[model samples]
Target: MTPSLLEALHWSTMDISGAEYRGKEVPLLVVPTRYLLKLDTTMISYCDMQRVLFEEEKSAYNQAMQQNICDGKIHPLTSIHHTSTYNSLCKLMEYCLSPAVTTLQDRLKENELRLSMLQEEAKQLEADTQNMRNGSPRRLMNHGAGGKSSPTAQSRHPFSNQGSPRSPSGGSRRRAC
Candidate 1:
């Protein structure tokens, strides 16, 4: 039944060999509508082809369907296409994300370093203030007379003291004989 149906196919204008050449006539293989419906009841077949075959002639559905029908085989191409697409998408994602990851790591390290430096500066300022309150400076310069500093030398006002002790009244405290 299948061989007879397939063998009966013929061109309405020309045939399958001349399908590439296009002018006015649509290249179509003419077959009985009953044979095509019985042989190609399912969606994907020679009958379902857009312009390859013509299956809309005389309707003889019930008589043609009574015979044994053999269907065409199909192969899917999605697996090949999807594998390549997955690889490309993965590469694109890595390319887009690399710079942000590097920048985030660098900024975190910089933040830690800056915080430690600020803590060390605070400790130094605390020590300097303690020294000022204790009536001493952080360092003392040596004079020609001696490198040894008197205990009371830095006890006066840091800006006003001239190495002499003066009474609070701004004069000598001794009485005249």
Candidate 2:
């Protein structure tokens, strides 16, 4: 809802709890809406009315609809079915429903769009994973008993040869104190 909408619809207040016209409860919830549409129609009614089309005047009209009515719930109207009153009310219904319908349609369209995008992304990832698996080698060694490296490679540098038989000291000679 916008202030222009309320202004276009000629709505003075948003609260409608105690609104009455000629002693009858006048449902003002739709008054602002009615006035908005009425303004739109009136502007377009005569060829020389110098009014802009709805789309052109949409911003202003929408602003009017956003007007808030605070605290004042009860209102008394002097007359019912005045030409201005009827037109304003009717416009309210048309404008309110129009945006709602558009919003619902847009949401559904966006949901469908996102669903398609996600599906495509999932398919691409799955294909990439499958390709990597197919290209990689399958054989793998477990690091248990037979598969373990020689102690020389695992513990000391191979070139150092601290325990090699080629050393000057015999392999069984214990070191002297």
Candidate 3:
């Protein structure tokens, strides 16, 4: 019935090979309503064919699974070493996180070192202040000054006893009581 319908639609015989279809004219059945219905029918048939093929494929797959099980094929769970997409994602996350972790560790270490150096400087400052409070004679020297000394120039100099012109007439002159 379908063949006859197709034949009735159009038929043209040509004496020349590779002839342009423009010169040829066959009786074209331009039933707009019927053509639309036919197109819909073809779509429906194609969908049905796809459905049957898919069902057959599912059944064949199930049979193959049963056969594999009977033949002592590797267990699905044990055979697969990795099926978790999460594991790969976690590995990628870790790979991305490692640099940040290392950077944080380095920054922490550097901060600790800076804190230690600051602590040492604070201790030295405290010791210096304590030394100043204790009235240590060397404190003035540390303060960049000549420490508490006598006003006499003769005693302050080592060459005062050598009788130099810069010394007084006496070898040394002591302050009056």
Q: Considering every candidate listed, which one attains the maximal lDDT? A: 3
RMSD per prediction, one decimal?
29.4, 24.5, 30.2
The whole-model C-alpha lDDT of candidate 3 against the native structure comes to 0.55
Candidate 1 lDDT over 20-118, as tens digits, reads 975797788999887667522442342244223222211222223333233532223443444465556556655655665576578779989999977
Q: lDDT for every model?
A: 0.48, 0.48, 0.55
Candidate 1 accuracy as TM-score: 0.29
Worst 10 residues of 1 by lDDT: 50-59
List clashing residue pairs in candidate 1. Answer: none
Q: What's each prediction's TM-score?
A: 0.29, 0.26, 0.34
Task: Write the residue-wise lDDT of candidate 3 on 1-177 in tens digits.
Answer: 698776755453333445756766688777668657764466557556655655665575556556557467756853332324334544655575566567667878999999997786667567656767887744533342342322233244544344333324464664343
Q: State residue 107's C-alpha deviation in candidate 2, in Å.
A: 2.2
Worst 10-residue lDDT window, candidate 3: 144-153
Better of 2 and 3 by TM-score: 3
Any runs in candidate 2 off by more than 4 Å, and if so which? 1-94, 137-177
- Candidate 2 lDDT over 133-152, as tens digits, reads 76642221122123343453
Task: Go through the candidates in order and give the clash count of each.
Answer: 0, 25, 0
Instruction: Kindly give the stretch of ten consecutive residues in candidate 2 with the minimal lDDT sum.
Output: 137-146
